[model samples]
Target chain A: MSDLQIKDAVKSYGNVDVLHNINLDIESGEFVVLVGPSGCGKSTLLRMISGLEDISGGEMFIDGELVNDVDAAKRGIAMVFQSYALFPHMTVAENMGFSLKLAKAHKSEINEKVRRAAEILQLEKLLERKPSQLSGGQKQRVAIGRAIVRNPKVFLFDEPLSNLDAELRIEMRAELIQLHKQLKTTMIYVTHDQVEAMTLADKMVVLEGGQVQQVGKPLELYDDPSNMFVAGFVGTPRMNFLPAEVVDVSNTTSTLRFAAENGAPEVVLPMTDGKLAIGSKVSVGIRPDHLHFSPAQSGDLAIPIDVAFVEELGDLTYVYVDTKAGTRLSSQKKDGRHNHGTTGYAVADTTSMFIFDADGHRVRA
Target chain B: MTDAIASPSALASNRRKIKVPSLWTVLKWIAAISVAVVALFPLWWMFSVVFAEAGVPVAVNPRLYPTSFTDGFAKIWEVFEETGYLRAYYVSIMYTILTIAGVLLISSMAAFEFALFDFPGKNALFAVVMLSLMVPLAVTLIPTYLLVAQLGWVNTMQGLVVPGLASAFGLFMMTQFMQSIPKETLEAGRLEGANHFQLYWYIALPLSKNALITLAILTFMKTWGNFIWPLVVSNTREVYTVSQVINQFNSPFSHTTVDVVMTANFLAAIPPILFFVFFQRWIIEGVQMSGSKG
Candidate 1:
């Protein structure tokens, strides 16, 4: 059985639903990330699991026990907040041991536990300093230490690294992975950043508009996203979408063609999945890395585009172009032949692109 | 000169700084000193009268320095012999301490609940507290006195302290300060196994140190110097606070001794003055530091 299970969990404010029918099973010692854009209900779902929010409907189970009605403190779960939330007047050791102290544990036990956690986080020397005296990174370490001392079954991190500088955030990400490996505990982290989600999580749950769009391993989601939103939201220099239509259908095979604005020679690609009607509107999504320059006279499909600008990074280059279909697409290429203020053709291999139906659901199974 | 309308006084001050002794500067200094002297003259005059020897007429020109300093100590001795001077100090100190304890407990607890919790009727209840501030203390005096008498607390310390404990203004100030603390801090405490009272006692109270100190000073000073409540409640020498005994020296059975009255008054003002002198920094800096980000 999974260590934590959320079965048909729903959360709603007065009259409006934030998350509906959420079903998730977090295995023991798995690092899961709930990734979404702002207002996508990832934080709300994490809060519900933490018992900080009331689940409007459905049930939550932790370690095979129903915890929907349990108080947050008794739920045996620990969370690290984005703001650090260390008590200003308390020393770092006291803040870390506060939970054990409130439990009326023996003084020696509390000190030992706090010391162990401090050693893990390398905060033993700063035990006597108050939260106000510590730098931002140290404060963050103390917050994590506060959770670590609890030895909780599952750890919840609500964008714990969002407040740090970029370099520190990256450093802390590696530290957190090390922490997870050492503890061997189930951890659920919430973030709006796909890059952090991709780097940190063992599994990713993509959410949009309060609904879980997809859940899989990070690279699995990156390679084969279920739909348009996940496909676009998961990658950097995001996927490019162009309009396409089903031209003809035969037994177990169908031909599709692009709907370019300007009349241009096109290659009709045939697929084995014959689940398409003739002349149906569809969207074609292809990653910029998949696009390649073909011979001038011939390619799978030639896209007439106006080159707007080119970004020349030392290792790579991004060519931004406006298509004849009036869609702005950026292509990633390592060769930095950046012609300023010039028009160029953007070519693509048709079979590499994903085709979506009118409902934005993938059609090429 | 470039921004003439924006800072004409600044420009004038710059021009005046050019090694010039002008008549207006001397007159400005005179006006400022006059205001300061006017504000502080009563305390100086009280000391002067208290120090003057018994039945010796005060100087015609009110003096800033006391004419005879040792007589003030002698007059205080005489007043203590005649009236309940020592007993008055005891009553006043106890009354002030109890009053501060009661008010701070009630107000801070109420303020914490108001700041942290969501319940029905919270806003309406706070509004009622605010509305009660508009009612003058005099209007409630008779009813309060009757209630105290009915409770068999007449001439008791309770009558002097309890009725003035739940101050509306103190509750309002405390609640505003409590609200300024970040909500995440309270939530952290809650998740750390703290109940409502624990949250208030441990988290809210510790974080609100500055506001609590300022409140303690204000409430202590106000209760120590109170006159009307203790006057109406305590009818005998055993229960008289310092301020009540000071009132007794005004006439003392038809023979008015102005010097004794001044001496008693001077003695009574010492505790509150010393309190303010030591803690005046908290009263000002507390307000400034409150709600500021770390």
Candidate 2:
């Protein structure tokens, strides 16, 4: 029953508000990731949940108890910082057993718990070594071991993988998933890396400008985003947005006309309840993978583009093209072709397209 | 033919490069030797006077080296017997040890607070502390002595040790060093249920070992050689430090010989010299750390 809830939480410094009206819930054993770009208040919200930062307004509950004023140590939560803040003078065993030692637990009990955590983290061989003697990956493992020894009701991770190298980050990402399955504590992790969020989170939260843009399962946000911000932020290389004008509206479909310089393309998308008036400006959003270099099919929209550059990433290549309207778009290709300086047609699947009005709000049919 | 001709010139150039030092290198050596001679000349003169033959008239015919070890040592024994030199040594050692302990503990704790925590008047209070450094010590000496006298501690160890414990330079140095410790480390301690004092003791204190050693050495050297405060406070023979006793020999009323006076000065200087010799590395390291951080 180690559920956590944050109700309308606000964080401010003097009069400048940094986090505005954040509300979230975490059930037992669920992995939630709060992700956004730098300064998006994701780290601030995590600090508030960990009780390191004070909540300027609203309530926080852990295990059904309001904990707005509780001390950070008494909140029954452990955090693994991005810096892996292991005491440099203490050995691995001593660091893992620090909280227990502070609690005045007996020597044998502390030793046993530390030993167990070391075994779990595969740190038994390095128990006698200091942090300065360990590698970056080992130090991160010891930090996790320290948290595991506490057996807190919840775990907070603030971009813990940001310090590791690319190969080691992938390795530790897998280890974190395994640790979550083994421990089954309610974990709230924060990061700005969408690939990490997509792979590790049971529920992903997208935040921008101190506000949560959307919160849902990773694929749900990817497949059916609630707003243009969520659609653009959730995927790698970003989704392509093209400006268009609504030309006509029927009972079941709406026709949009792109600029004449872009092959004068017209796309008629399915709409059950059309509320858009003619001559209204809108942007059509499509993921990079949904755009293909082949010719258009029955219901696809085709637009001419100049291939600006191609990035060949072994198994997959990314094609960055410039449309005639001076819009730069990226499309993922699996053929690993080098099509630089070649003008080509990009066919966009209309079924997977997203439509947004001038204010960046989704217009669902 | 061109290769053979070029080889000899290249060889000659390489030989000249190896044999001739740069003008900058020559100037650096000259400057270093000049400073060394200026610093060491006084020490050599002191030793030359200490070991000169009795009634040798060293001022008229100064010897660069010792004339006789036996006369110098015999004079030292006589001075020790006549002037309570051993008791002065004990008193000076105790004063230096106690003052060093007090200064390190007080200043390091002050530094931890000033560097790590935030309070209502944090910046203003630190500004005041920094301002205290600007006021000359001579200005405070009379007032401080008057306060000590009013407390009826003119000849007490507390008067000697307590008044000098709040070192502005030490607090400033230590605060700079402590600020370099990552705040995340202290926050980790906070999350582990450690209080402020525990954090200071277990975390901050251990991390500040180099700065502490550096401060201790500086305090040790300063307190060991202090003469003015003891002269102002200790009018009795029992509380006299080595520096006071050394000054007593050079006083106008005393008839102590030059060799005996120089012997006392030489003995009083050995502890500081040995201390500097032993811990010079930490002082350099601590200074570099403080420099970069500050």
Candidate 3:
């Protein structure tokens, strides 16, 4: 019952606009993640929805009620801060029961609600300990417990697990997903971590410079990005962009030549709708995971590369490569492409590559 | 090991690296103790005078110590018995407690706003509070007295306590101390459906237990030992505070007795001393706990 609709929402400090025309409709029980790099306005958008930050313009509705002018508490939203924001003086049970007590609930009712949340969080044993006595992971659980007791319409988490260590962060991330499923409530989580956005979100909104770049499911954004920024930001180890020039165009296909070492010929790519004109400067994008070592030195489709470094992460190896013309790119070195030397590694794969115009808008290949 | 291998002079000069005191260090301790003793000699002299007989000849040097040690105790008991000095003691304690309670309420509440909230002219208003700290009480004595008289509270406890409550110094200390507390904690309180007052009462107050204790100590000591305000505000002996009534030993209506005044001074010093000893743990525990806060 906690669906949220934000219409033409804008946020600014004086004349300096920080978030521009943000429009989103979140369905009930959906886990939506607003994610971007630092200063990209994800936190601001979350704060606005939580009613912590005032919306400079436009409307916000939560649970079919216009909440733009409502106080944070009355808006039926609970926010978990990055710092956890647990009351240090109160024990775990008291912290969990604060909202209920403030609502003037009876002592027994408060205790029952607190006990329920503690049991769910597995914090029953630590109920008597203060926030300072708890470990980092334990503190975060208590923070979530505090939020759970309220049973707010929407749960707003502002990088709640960013403070945890990497291993703990992974563990907490999985737990948060499970918690959302168990509660069957709408949750809006904000983070700059793409991995968090990809893994935890049912739908991900990628933002950059205070504007919505793209929004889709995790793999949808990964497989088919709307623009160059979305393509570069959504994937891990990122997609590579190389300077490309259109050579010859016919009815349905265009021959494209990319910047490469001397004597590399052009490659053929199928084009639709005649979107790219001949001699137009464009950028070619290749995903690291999508790339394979193309069959041995086929044509100009293969660029001569010198290996800069190799990062082996268990199941996959990422080879950092720089073409001889100084165009840098990374390729997934699968199927024994482990040639590391001064000799140029001629590599190319046209099976799954992207093309973007000079304006950074993607033209489907 | 690196510290042990360091040069002798370097190690001696460095506080962290220093192992033991050298010849120079022993001399420094002796010098510091000498300065402290010289500074405390006046208090010792006052205590000594409390023991000497009350009616000793004015021209002669008083006996260093009376024949009976109970002379000071006996004289102190007589002052309470004969004079209204005991009532003065009661009045002082009552008003000092009231004044501190009022000041803590007003200052901590106001400071919470200044530290956490945003509003128009916030800095300008805060600057005015800061500026009041620089204006000495002496400068406002006449106008303040006139206002107290106008209110017809000249010799009442309210006039005495109310005028001195809400000090800029206390407000500034509270604001700065509360500012050091992370804003996220209070914001959490807000999300818990707590309004500004509840946030102050529940989150700010509990988090600032040390600061409140420290401020309470300062306020209690200041109002307890205050002289001029009480003297000017109250002329009736019934309303006389400890500091004001002690002047009566100089013989306002009759014979002067330095011994009883010294005894009063000695008794006055006791409460503050006990107060410090009781709450010194808070004063010593550096204002706050460290990083473990969520």
lDDT of 3 by residue, B1-294 (tens): 366577877666795664778989999999999999897776676777776655652327655444446887887788778768779889989998998888888889888889988899999999998998789888999999999999999999998999888788778888888898798898888888999889999999888877777777777877888899998999998899888767777656756466667777787777777877887776455334321110
lDDT of 1 at A246: 81
What's the C-alpha lDDT at position A194 in model 1? 98
In order of appearance, the predictions have TM-scores of: 0.92, 0.92, 0.91
Better candidate number, 1 or 2, judged by DockQ: 2
**In DockQ terms, which candidate is top?**
3
Query: Can you write out model 1's per-residue Cα lDDT over A104-204, one digit (the tens) per residue?
Result: 99999999999999999999999999999998899999999999988888899999999999999999999999999999899999999999999999999
Query: Which residue pairs come into collision in candidate 2?
Result: none
| Pairs that clash in candidate 3 | none
Show the lowest summed lDDT stretch of 10 residues, model 2 chain A: A291-300
What does DockQ give for each predicted structure?
0.63, 0.70, 0.73
Stretches off by above 4 angstroms in model 1 are A262-267, A293-298, A336-341, B1-33, B57-64, B67-69, B286-294
Where does the lowest 10-residue lDDT sum fall in candidate 1 chain A? Answer: A292-301
Candidate 1 docking category? medium
Q: Model 3 over residues A1-365: C-alpha lDDT tens digits?
A: 48999999999999999999998989999999998999999999998998888999999998788988999889888989999999999999999999999999999999999999988889999999999998999999999999999998999999998888999999999999889989989999999999999999999999999999998899999999999999999887899887779988887788888764533568788886488899998888888876544434653367766677777765677877667777667878655446455445445556577889999999985
Compute the lDDT of residue A20 as modeled in candidate 1: 82
